[model samples]
Target: MEQAEIQAHQSTYEKEIKDQLDIPLETLWQDAPIEPNWGIKKNSDGKNTFWFWFGFKGHLAVTTKSQYITSRLMTSANLSDSKVATPLLKKVEDQFPEHFTTAILDAGHDYEPIYRQLQGDQMGAVIPYNVRNEPLMP
Candidate 1:
């Protein structure tokens, strides 16, 4: 692609993200609506990997040493896991301030805002990269 084309694409993408972020976070999960969760079928090649189920997804923040849930949130399966991290962490922080020092999470929680929140809370975030959403090198 030409330089102009790349710049235009980036500009459009940034605008779309800003528009999405403008929506109130609370409204994002005000209702428990059935949504699709995409899953890959086992023993299938990349071409036929897609499958889904309509349901809700449960997210939990647990105490590492005690194995007890400190916070939880449920949302439509379609919701991105990254979207719930900050809220869930906030809840944990409110209830158990200074109780934990690190958050271990999967690649789905690999988002800039989530990391920023963790940093602001004086906590460490151990999350892998979501290749589809981020550049390989950071």
Candidate 2:
């Protein structure tokens, strides 16, 4: 192809990618509804613990056994971990559909909707949240 044609093709490809990856302006600037788990607090032992103030929170998906980080998502700190779990999992699923079969998350990701969605997708979930006083079986 001619140099001009090649340049035109490259420009078109770049535009297409930019369009696909674009986020809405409102969503980009939206703040979390509440303050994050930051600031200093005194523990029961009278020791002060200081948590750094970060505007955003990072969620990471790692291999269970290997501990290799596979995917990550960043959101405003005010957003709960449960709120972003599905979106982060969906991104990972899109990237590696055939690799992951189960997801193990903490209590913060113990939302029923997330569990149901994972179940619908034939994915196993291991979330330990104490809705009742019963112990969760492994």
- Please name the candidate that would achieve the greatest TM-score relative to the true structure: 1
Candidate 2 lDDT over residue span 1-138, tens digit each: 996676566521122222212333233224223335442323424457644565667778899889988877665564556655655566676677857889999765666667775775568999887454256879
Give the lDDT of residue 3 in candidate 1. 68
Candidates' lDDT values, in order? 0.65, 0.59
TM-score of each: 0.65, 0.56
Mark the 10 consecutive residues where model 1 has the least summed lDDT: 11-20
- Counting clashing residue pairs in each candidate, in order, gives 0, 0
